[model samples]
Target chain A: MSKLRPTNRSILRRLALFAGLTCFVAIVMFPFYWQLVTSISPPGQLTQLTLIPDLNNASTDAYFFIFRERNFGRYLYNSFGVASLSTLFGISIASFSAYAIARMSFPGKALLLGLVLSIAMFPQIAIISPIFLFMRDMGLRNTWLGLIIPYMTFSLPLSMWYLTAFFKTIPDSLEDAARIDGCTPIQAFSKVIFPLALPGVFTAAILTFIYAWNEYLFALTINTQDAARTMPVGITMFQGEYTLPWVETSAAVVSVTVPLAIVVLIFQQRIISGATAGAVKE
Target chain B: MEIRKTDGSRLRKGLSERQTAYALILPAMLVIFAVAVFPLLQTFYISLFDLRLNHPTRNARHFVHKLNLEQYVDMTDRGRSALASLSDSDVSDDVLRRLPAIGETLDRLHDTLVSNPDRLDQYERVRDLVVTFEPVRESSLRYFRISGLEANEALSLAEQLQDDVARAIAATRESPSRQLRVLEQISQDVGRSIVYPNFIGLGHYAAHFADTRLWSSLINTMTFVGFAVLFELVFGMLIALLINRKFLGRGAIRATVLIPWSIPAAVSALIWRYMYDGQFGIVARALDAVGLIGDSSVMLSTGSGAMVSLIVADIWKTTPFMALLLLGGLQTIDGTLYESARVDGARSYQQFFRITLPLLKNTMMVAIIFRSLDTFKVFDLVYVLTAGGPANATETLSVFAYRLMFRQMNFGSGSAVAVVVFICITLLSVVYVKALDSDMLTGHK
Candidate 1:
């Protein structure tokens, strides 16, 4: 009876703590939830300030406006193209470099590792001038290549670093076994290690994609023309020289961000693990 | 001859192994060299030249050739000839050798007069040079009459020599001013002409270090990062510890806390900007209700208020991230450590200090570094919230660099600012890496 009484009291205390946490979480989530609601709420009712949109007032006018009036589809396509290319190119290069750092007994491996990691720490603003000049000279400005090239600089370092960590966790014995079977280094990496490191590759790919997608400074600086503007750059158009359309802007924000949120939700576990693993040892 | 077949096979295998290794690492190295290192070298090269696109004549081969050492010697000879023609007496090499020393003495005298206005009459030579240089140009005929030296007779050659000396001093003063004006004009023109040029130098960095505006912006950035990180660490730790125990619907609560972290930073910034808007936002309404602020309070209009609002928004968005990291660290601690502390008759506070704080150091450091770096380069939130406005009170180094590079088209200074930020972050990164290394080595064993 004494044990039961204490257990009952602890259960009630646990319930109270859970309720408090739920409230805290709701407060944390309110901004995103409000953004979603504001995106779908009818234009006239957007300012009503309700938690949920009235069923009769719900509409897709803001999204429709973004598509027809704002040329948002083009921006989305540009964002997808640049982000996809950067992620693809970044991962391919990082995978090889990561392999070299993790497995090869190179003379300057420590210096190379330190240099690569240092690149990740640099702020893009500092290198903007020289990068802009280089882009202009190469005839890359106002083109997708201008944005993609610099975006690679940011993502490649991160990909190389994280992928290096992931590659280190894999035992060398696996690679040796393949070599013993007369498989060359390339074949061994492809046939044996590559398949095993898919999760890590996936993690790197997602991170690279997200970083490129959300990157604003390089995109804003390099690509001034609308044809090559990414989603984040496109959103800046809502703040006109004299006026800001808050409602339509919120709607546009929802459109681009929802897809990212969905991706995060789907791959939450992998992302959490990858993020913590990279961070914990830093 | 018997082992020849085995030897050939071994040689082929060795060659193939080298080739495979090269193929694996070559592409990444090439990309890094082309994209990162090449531009850095190119920027360094450009900074060495006095290249400005605005000087149309200077763009020609003749002007470029004229900048050589031979042309500079020719200009010096011509200046000497001009002074000699006015004096009507050939100045000897001995006098020319003493000219620089005499000029330095005159400059010191002038500086003393300028600093103390009462000392003006004490420096007669400098005063004569300043007064007569322009009048001598206007009244070339009167130059000899005023000094009582006949123009044709060149009477009292020493007085004519004094005139030459004054002219030389005047020319020296005017030459630097003229060069400065020309340089300024060229820079202004270049600023207007270049679309985007890779300019690399420390000029902007020096200017920023000297300017009070840059210091103020840096202080604001540090203030924002320091307060936000400090508060987030404390609040996030408390929240994480509170929810560490098993609870009903804990999963739901944890998922909800992740919403802010999951939301795009840009969108959240915009949302908070709206919430803090004075015209009819939730923050203003709540503050009014509590009588803490007036109904007409514009949270973002005032400098302190805007800073506080920015800090609040950042804390809201990032506390979840801090909590998540701390929660992960909390889970790693052995519960038996706490049990033992309690068995030793320690209070709850003592147990937390003894068992929890020391164990959580590594996780806390990681969180602080990440958060501090993110806050250091804060652009999206500040850009969306204030645009570094209300008289440029909140302009961070990044924002200032952007305005210089994009708005004013001053790539040189902008590049310099970028270098400063890079150096600062690099130093921070070194500290972080050292701390992490020590933490890992200590914690693992």
Candidate 2:
């Protein structure tokens, strides 16, 4: 009976906790809400500072304005193309390297781990000058391959870290069983282990996609051509003709963010796990 | 090269484990090398010389002195034809007397330019490219490296010819101003046609060491990283603690909070810049309404205000990520321990200090190390939002390096800045490894 009806003190405590959590979340998410409100409003009433815009007056005219005026579709294609290619290449490359590091007891394993670790910590600016020059000389400055190569390289460290740890957690008994059945290590990895590690590879895919999608420095440097810019560079250098640029920028942000926000919403747990890969112990 | 062991259980002969492992990682190592290691070495190598792409003579990295043969040939060839016309009967005797000496100097310079057999060969090819214009592309073929003594001899001859031209110019003051100007310009062009070797060993580093901009940017980087990490940790802990408990809207709260971190940094900068806008931003108006500032414009205008505003945005953008990390750490804590502490009548704060804080140290170390290095290399946020603006109070090392390397096209100094950033991050990593744990290298908790 007492458990069914909590005490006033406990009720108040729960209410206070809920209220605090709600307030903090609202504060954190208010920027996105504001961006939405600003993006939905027509250019005439954009600066009205209304929490709830007059629904009858609000219009998503700016979305059409961005696509029409700016070559936003090109940027969208470039971002998606570059990000997907890099993620695909990054996953395959990182998986092989990570499997060797995790499963095999071999010489030079520690040195290889150290090499990849430092490459992970290697700052992008340290190599930007030479890369820009090299890409320009190679006639790859405005191409997708140029961006994909660097993106793939930088994404290797994180994917390798996550996949190595994930592979280590899988029992060795499974591989031994497969080997006893006369399967090679590669055959076992593909036939038996690879299917089980799909969750980890999926997590790495999401993270690396996000990385290549959000990468600004390389994209800004290499792909300065109007048609080759990614979403980040496009929105940063956004210029709208009729609608205000800020609103169009907000619309661009909204368009790209909606797809990603859905991914984050659906995979928040996996994303968190992937993010805190090496930071937390099981 | 298959070797079958006599007593092996498996019958088929294939690659050894060591060879297979090496083969597996060979592609990744090559990619990393091509992208990261090779470029890093190239940048460091380029930093040793004064490489300026915009300047005509100093564009390429040269080891020895060279003459800009295209411009030198064009100027002298045109001067010879134009000066020959000035030797008509109407020209003054004083100028006429000096004319042969100038012509003789030009002939001597031509001989000296192609004097050595080696230079003569290289210069003839370049002269063919310049002189034959239709077949060969002259753009890529320029700047032959010449000997020091030849360079000195050619430069002295050019100087003597310029002095003779000046004397002739003074004697022929009756000539048209345009003719005098053309004569003066030819002499100047002839004098300005030598490319000096721009080999400044360690000079960029030494000069940057004394530069206040470098030191102040370092200080700014430290200040930004310190405060951002500190606030993110505190707020991240609070949020982590709050969300760790059983709640109805926990999923919604977690997902909603992650939206900021999921948003691109450049986009986050855009949202914050809008929210911190003086006239139309709701946050600005609310801050003004609360008397937090004299006006809304003050947030983005003043240096401290801009820093504080950006810091607040950074905290908002990244605190969720930090919280998510701490929450991962928090979940790994055995719940029964907390329950035992509660049964022992220990208060929540005491339980936190004794149990959670001590247990969360490793996670904190890893999180802080990653975040600090990342924030130290912060470019997109500062680059898009403030752009080291108002007075450069917000300039970090990455931003400074970018401005020098990309915007100013000063690759040498910019690379020095980049190397400084790399060193500082390395120093920080060394400190963390020494102070935190050796497990960092192993990527083990």
Candidate 3:
């Protein structure tokens, strides 16, 4: 009975905890909210220091401007095309290698794992100059392939790490059982293991997509022409010499962010798992 | 190749499972090599050469000092015109006397350079093609081999003659037309046309090691990484702890917090940039209203303010990610351990220190290592926000290298900077790896 009603001390502690947690949540959510408000608010009223977004003056002018005035649509297509292709290539390539690492007792396995992880840690700037020159020499610059190739290379490690962990979790007994049931190794993997590892595959897909989507430095350097520029590059270029035109930039920002925001929302748990799957133990 | 066992009459051989496994991984290995390792090796190679795309003559890799034939031809033509016109012009007695002497010297140098008729023909052909904006196919015909000393002597002599002509023109006290200035400029430019071999192996690296800008940028990078990761770790831990408990709206809180992490970094930068704007920024206004800052503009205007602003935004942006990782770590911790600690009369703080921290060490190490590396190579944030600006206070090594490589088009120096960044990053990774491994070993012990 006494446990039913909390004492003042316990109540105070709970209140304090709730207050702190709320503050954290608020801090995390506020900047995004501010961006939305600024993006929607009338250009003239963007400077107004209103605590709440003035709904009355809200307009989709900036969004319209991005789609109409700029070649942002082209940037959008390029970003999506490159990111999707990279994700496809990255997953297909990594899955095979990840499975081999998981199932096969291979020589130099540790070294191979170490190499992939080290590649993940490589600073992009270190190779930017060389890649720029090489890409130009190969006539790959300002093309979707140029961006996709590097993106796949970098994103491969993450997908491999996730898939390897997932594949390792599936018991070896399942494959042995499938073999006993007259299934070839390939048939067993495709029929049994692949279906089970779908979640891991999805995780890799989401993470890789986001990476190629968000990638700026490589995209900025490798693609100089307007048609080949990604969303990040396009939005950055929008901040031209004369004026920033914050409203249009914000609208472009929203366009780039909304699709990612939707993916995160829909797959928040999987995204979280994928992200922390790297740092945390299985 | 087929192998036969002595016990077996013959061994039917095809690709082994191990070979298939190797085959599966081969594509990934090759891709990594082509995209990552090959570029890194190429960067190292390029760093050894003196390659600048901007300079006309010294643009390509030069192993030996050579006179650029294209430049030599253009300068000879221009010099001939300048000298020939100078003799016809009304000038001082000193100018009249020096004009003929300078012209003769120019002719002598021209004659000496073109003494080989074959080389002269190649030079004239290349010159004609260059003047017509046609690409010269043969590099050998474009640059003539010349000793460094000879090139230097000719350059100095030409410069001295130019100076004398300028003085002679000034002595007349007549208004110098644009034509005269153009003539003087052409004369001055001819000396620079001599391309000296700029291949200085390990020279940029040597110079950069002592370079103040490099050191300062390194310091800035370290400071930013240290503070940003530290803040993220602490805040992340706190959030992780708070969210780890059973709560209503837990899913909502989890998803809401991750929005920042999900947003593109460049977009987040833009958002924060808007919020940190000196004018019309709600954050700046609010901070000023609360008297935390003397003025709103100080946030983005000053170096320390901009740094603080960036740190705050970064903490906000990444703490969720850190929290998510820590939360995953937290989930791995057994609840029964806490119950046992409580039964043994341990307080919550004592229980946390004893139970949570030691176990959480590995996760923390992993988080810190990854975050530190990411922050160390920070470019998009600093770039989109302050652009290493108000005077380069926030300029990290990556940004510095990017500026050098792209904006300035100094590939040789920029490649050196890139190499330095890679070395520093490798060192940082090694430190973390060693620390993590040692901690694990000690934990096991």
Candidate 4:
């Protein structure tokens, strides 16, 4: 009762908590603020000591420069191509595996699950050079196929994990009822179960696409040609071509990341849950 | 009972179900194998051999001592023509005498290579293929094995003869001609024909045992992961606890937390890089104002400073994910447990230590394991930020391997370093599984 009272001690504790939370929030949000500030600041004002840009003078010149000069539009197009294709491939393959894991009584199910989890954690560096070599030999290097296959491969484990958990929640009785009504197992899955699993599939697709979009090392190594490079690799390489042009670099960074930020904001709950799907379930 | 007379239709249905399950999983399994398993195995295999693309002689893995026929044939033909012209050269007698000795050395080389009729035939076949502008079909046939001793002997003899001829030609300064100089160049080409075997099994890995660079990079990697993850775990848990409460705008706060994570790592690196810029970075100026660091430039300029800057950047980027994970763990803890503790007159801190911390262990372990592995393989952040620069001080294992393999084009050494990274990752995985064996076994469901 004494501690619960609004005594000086309790007031100090409340102030401490608020201070901690404010610092945490500020630190978490400052980078985006800085990114935005740098993006809008006039090229001449980039080296200004102030953290915030002068609103009246802030210009979109850097953005126009990114599009007109750096060819970031092409990078965006390539990134979208790789990300969406990989997501489609990842979701499709993961659907069946998730279906089997969720519905079937397969031998080695545990082993398969363990293997998928391990693959999710496989370091990309370990296989990067080999993938480069193999792709070159197969004449796939610098092609979209080169980046998509590895992206799909790495995306499978996470997609499968998310989808399997989702599929488990759907009742088997619906599929069985469809079977009894004269639908084939595949038909039963497609008509009855597949519709029910949309949310999970969407989550997996979004996550996979984000993974493919944001993946750097594979995209960097696999696509040496400028025409084939993805956004992350493209933008990183932009830094090399332009010598520390913070305004233009920030413009490019904001353009690539703003869409993601907006999407995450709009779908905050879904994205958060999906991202923490593994840990939450455990 | 009547064996249930397994209904024919039902039996067929069951068989079809099993088949469908197999059919469903087949594509995913194939993709995983082709893209993940095969390359990993290939990496391991390649690391066992010396496969440097830069070296003319040992550019590829050689299972046995091999002489390059394309090289040998070209050299021998050039040598013979040079000798033919040199015998009639208007150079001094000393130079003319030297031509025969070079011819003798060339002859000896030809005899050693041609001693094995099978090889000589292959060599002749390769020469005809080359002359006809036909490509060699097999890498193996393109270079045939010679006795290591014989190859060494031929190499030295050709080299010596080349030097001798060049000296004699140079001595005939009065009769110096472009033809004599071309002869000197041809002999040098002949000297470079021997290709050594490149099978260095476990040699690359063996070399790392004493490799200081490898050790330093490994240490850097471990230090980065250890400090970053530890701080992330603590601060992440605190943030999770702070935000896990039912507060207004908590959803907005949660989304705000995810922003750093949603942004591409390369983008995050760029932002941090500018923010930490010595002259203009707001963060650098702020830190300097607060006296946390001596100056902003020192942030990315010094070894320890670069490492610190990187760790701070990593912590900033990843701690939110940690918080999200821990929040997931926090949610699973029953609200009633805290109410019951309150009724029993336990303080909040007491309840936290006894209840929340214990319940959050599994999720924490999983989070830490995942984050540690991620931090260990950190390449891009270090790459785009400090570039492991200011004297190789911040070079993590992955960046080190990238430089070796892609930059230096030393695939053999790079692959070897990659394998070392694989071993480190495996060790981390084993530790995680061992620590959370029962948790992992039960968590999948």
Candidate 5:
């Protein structure tokens, strides 16, 4: 094929592909670059029309302002606490259900799976107000549990799906052999299959944690008080508070996103696989 | 493939595995029911009645005609005492003759509260709280909700007494004393005893159907979904094909591609918002230089510009995930099919059309429909970026519902908007389910 085509034309084609890929990569990355630049830029330089970033003059004052004056430290603490608890709860509950769905053939197994799929996709807006009402009635408003329960439950569908697919990939013979060794079903599962399914559980927990960490609507509605507000809601509140510098918003966003970005980068393979787990059966 | 899942479990079912399975799944199902399903049902129920949190009397769902005894008792009592203390010089002879009737009317109303065996004790407790100046925050104690005939009579009587005070105050303007003025002021302060029935059956739904805002948002939502999914599918397919090819730095490239999808949506919105800033946004300036946009500010400052900006941001953020979905489909295509086609002397483009495109159709369809559904319920991005701003020209249904429920405190209308969204999504889901009636759904082999 190289011999058939002219050398000049082939070079042009190669150059075009390289440029397209470079442009795509640039498009994917420029926002974060802009975010970093904006976060580091001081209030005086925020409105400057310079396209290039100024790193030497960068300041951490915006970060300090958010932590000190805006109570973003509380929001960060709240987000971490809620996301961790939600992941823990989601992982624990999903393990058993995933095991059952993957292992046994219950009567309503098909029906249950269908229901789970839809519930996983249930729109949060539909339930936001009712949950608010229930939270108020249960005295859960501005409480950690108010946000935790919804986050954990909403994540159940995906967690269960991935865990089920993960559990399915594990052979049943291990547990069968454990049963033959005089172990009960629970004991066999704990000793044999659970160990094999640990990776799936971890992956499910990562996804769930990300889901909880990124969540804003429930956090905003349920946790109205500064004591319980999460990072996403707290940062949005930064605006309309005496017309502060736009740099503060950038600082808050970078602080929240960088950790998640780092984690996702490290676990990119597992996260990617977990997302496409059962969706592509082939 | 695993017939043992049926026969094997049945043969070794000594430990009640069915019961165990149910028990294991019970907690997850219960949580889902409580958090999602129950609240969703409750939202539907709330949408039937007017639940405006900002409105004092209509904050909660009212089941019957109710009296606000706290305000009623205090104001009526003040009116009667103020009228009785009036001097002879303060009013005309006719008004003096009418004073006893109005006083008796007030006492009778008070006597009803004090005399009723069911309400007398509760009324006294409420009176004590009012006198001590404590806020009756609890609705159960403050609002006297009843379905009895007394509810109607008390409501009418309160109105009549208020009217009488007005008449007396107007009639004695010539002798204007502070006593009658106090009575008039108290009567004016006394609110209606009849609590409003906020139950508007299908009223919100009907009103929304007629609302232009809802239609505009629906248009915005569909436009965003349509354009986002379309561009995502096409570009995602191209990216998937490119990355799926053998490359040296493929792992690094894949990780780079996953950045947008990995970052939380709200953070993505903020990043885009900064870059699309009218005056200082780099991307805006770039677009202006390329003549893609007339100006940098128009993207967030105009309706068409905002919509286009939203679609572009969505495409940028989600095309990576879309590519991943398609890549999953791409990997499933047997490699030998391409080798065999090459042996048949088929060109690369021909092989792609014959071997790859046909096989990738299912994943493409499913990814598009699923992506469409996700885009339909977008709130965080639109909310954080523009907040349906630039005069709310960018408001989608979810944004509209958020404003109605949380911002406007109209849960009823908001829930109505929610239910409308639910119905639309459920319809789309049914289509998704129909498309997914394959072996993957059954999970057998």
Candidate 6:
């Protein structure tokens, strides 16, 4: 009877906890929900204070304007192309380098690791002008290559640095066993090591893609032409030279942001784990 | 069987050797070298040339030359003498017609004066000499000689001298105290000039050290970063504590809390900017309803208002990040610590201060430093929200650099600003990296 009393009290405490957590969660998620609601609400009803819009007033006209009037689809393609290419190139180069750092006893290994990590801390703006001049000299200004090259500079450092840490976590014994079983070094890496480190690779890919996609200054500086501009840059075009069209701008914002939100929700666990793993591992 | 055994042994040796590591690392190193190191060196190289694309061929060799005010004055004196002699000469039409060589000499002299502004006083002296000849020709034409060949030649020479003197005066008038300022302005006009110039032994550092704007921005950045990080940490800790408890739909709550962090910073900042819009924004209306200010109040139009807006926007976006980090830290703390504290009759506040805080010190530092460094580099929020407006109240070092590089097109000064920011962030990173190396958060010895 006494144990039952404490158990019942605990259940009540848990119920109170649920209510508090629900409130906090609502506060946390309200902005995104608001974004979605505002994005879809009729132009007339957008200013309404209510959480839920009148279904009769809701329409996808804003989205239509964003696509038909703004050409947001092209910006999406540019962002996708730049981010995907950078991720692919950054990861492949980082993996091979990470593999060497993790497995082989190389001369100046510490120095190489130090250099890669140090470059990660450098502000991109410091080198922006020189890079701009270099690209112009090479006839790469306002081209995809202009944005991609600098994105690689920023992405490769962190990718190589983090990938190296992840590579170190995987046991070398597995690679050694593969080698003894008549696998070449490259074969052992691809067949055994690469598969084992897919989580790290995914983490690196996600981080690289997000970094490249979210970048603003470099993208703005390097890609001035509409053909090369990404979503963030394209969003600025919605705001004319002086006046901003809030309704249309919000529509563009929602379209560009929704895809990223979907990505985050789907990969929440991996992101959470990956973000904390290196920091926690010391 | 013998061939296979030999091949296996060779492969093992190759795998274990340093050569394989070099092979793997070489490509990345080459890319880094090509992309990062090469450009930096090239920028330095470009800085040494008097290479303005607008005026490409002027003083190309002496781009590395540094002249003092005295040397400039001497050069200007020589130019003045040459101009004076040419003005005073008596030559026939044919002789005067062959003076294109003298014209070329005058052009070179003008280039020297324009390129080197430390000689401005000397340029002013030359200008004075030419101006003296200007009225003499006009007076002589009006009174003595009207339309003769001799009169035309004298008037033409006087006009040419007058134009050259005026150009020299204009160049000198545009000179700034520091060589770097002149170089930066020149670089902007000539887009192909080096992005970051290293003028060795320049006193720009001293000048910047004395500048009040630098200190003010630094103090503002520190205050903003400190408040934002501290408040976010506190709010985040509370939220983490709430979420850590066993609750209904905990997974959903966790995901919801992460929503703010998931939104891109630029998008969130833009959203917040609209939310704080003075005319129709919900916040403006809410504030007005409470009589916080007039209905016509511009929340971002004043310095304090802009700062407050930035802090609020930052807290909203970053509290979730802090919560996520703290939650990870919270998970590592054993529940037994709380149980033990309760058993010892310690109050909740006591338990928190003694047990929770002490245990979370390193995690707190890690989170604080990371957030602090990030906030110090605050750009998108300030850029979108206020753009260092209302009399440059919100201009952080990063914004200052942006204005210099992009708006002003002064890459040299912009690079200097960037270097300063880099130093500040590097200092913070060093502390964090040290904390990371010591396994402070993991509680490892």
Candidate 4 CAPRI grade = medium
Give the winner by DockQ.
Answer: 4
Candidates sorted by lDDT, descending order?
A: 2, 4, 3, 5, 6, 1
Candidate 2 lDDT over B1-445, as tens digits, reads: 2234574622323336767788889999999999999999888888887887677677677767877777776677678777777775466677788788778888898888767786677666766666666343454355566678888898898888878778878877586444445666787677567778888888899999998999999988898999999999999999999999887879988999888898789989989888888877788888999999999988888888888877888899999889988988898899999899999999989999999998898888878988888899999998888888768988889999999888888988899899999989889989988877555445464
Model 3 lDDT tens row, A85-203: 99999999999899889987668789989999999899999999888887898899999999999999999889999999999999988887886687765787789899999888999
The window of 10 residues in a row where model 3 chain B has the poorest summed lDDT is: B7-16
Model 6: how many Å of interface RMSD? 3.4
Q: Write the per-residue lDDT of candidate 6 for residues B1-445, one digit (tens) a residue.
A: 1123577876767556667778888888988888877665554443333333333322122323222222333333454454445435653434344334445644553454344453454446534645455322232111211123333343344355445334433444334223223322322322121122224332334555688776777776787787888899989999888877765566666666556676657777777777777764667667878888666356778877777778888898879778878888888899999999899999879988998888787778778876787788877667777787768787888877777666866555555666677778889898777876676546765
> TM-scores for all candidates?
0.75, 0.92, 0.88, 0.93, 0.90, 0.77
Q: Is the docking of candidate 5 incorrect, acceptable, medium or high quality?
A: medium
Docking class of 2: medium
Query: After best superposition, candidate 6 residue B211: deviation in angstroms?
Result: 3.1
> Which CAPRI category fits model 6?
acceptable
Provide backbone clash counts, one per model.
Answer: 2, 0, 0, 0, 0, 0
Q: Which residue pairs overlap in candidate 2's backbone?
A: none
Candidate 1 residue spans exceeding 4 A from truth: A1-12, A44-48, B1-23, B37-203, B246-259, B295-297, B345-347, B433-445
Q: What lDDT is reached at residue A11 by model 5?
A: 81
lDDT of 4: 0.84
Error of 1 at A22 (Å): 1.5
Which portions of model 4 miss their true places by more than 4 Å? A1-21, A240-242, B1-14, B87-94, B174-176, B438-445
Cand. 2 TM to true fold = 0.92
Model 3 misplaced stretches (Cα beyond 4 Å): A1-14, A173-193, A240-243, B1-15, B70-111, B114-133, B138-141, B153-193
TM-score (second chain) of model 2 = 0.89
Ten contiguous residues with the weakest lDDT in model 1 chain B: B142-151
Per-model TM-score (chain A alone): 0.93, 0.95, 0.94, 0.92, 0.93, 0.89
Model 1: per-residue Cα lDDT at residue A186: 80
Tens digits of lDDT, candidate 5, A1-282 = 646866897789667766777788888987777777888886687667355866678788988888888888998899899999989988899898889899876788898888898986688999999888889989999988888899989899889999998888888788777877778667877989998888888899999988898898898788999878888788777777445357888888788777777888899889998887756663
Model 3 C-alpha RMSD to native: 4.1
For candidate 5, write residues B1-445 as lDDT tens digits: 2224677575667347787889888998899888888888888999999889998678878867777878876777667567757744545875686677667667766665445666777787787888888877777888765555665566566666777766666666476678877776765555455477788889999999997989989998999899999999999988898888765677887888888887767777877787787876777777988999998888889989888889989999999999999999999999999999999999889998998998897788778777898899999999988889888799999999999998899999999999989999999888777766653465446
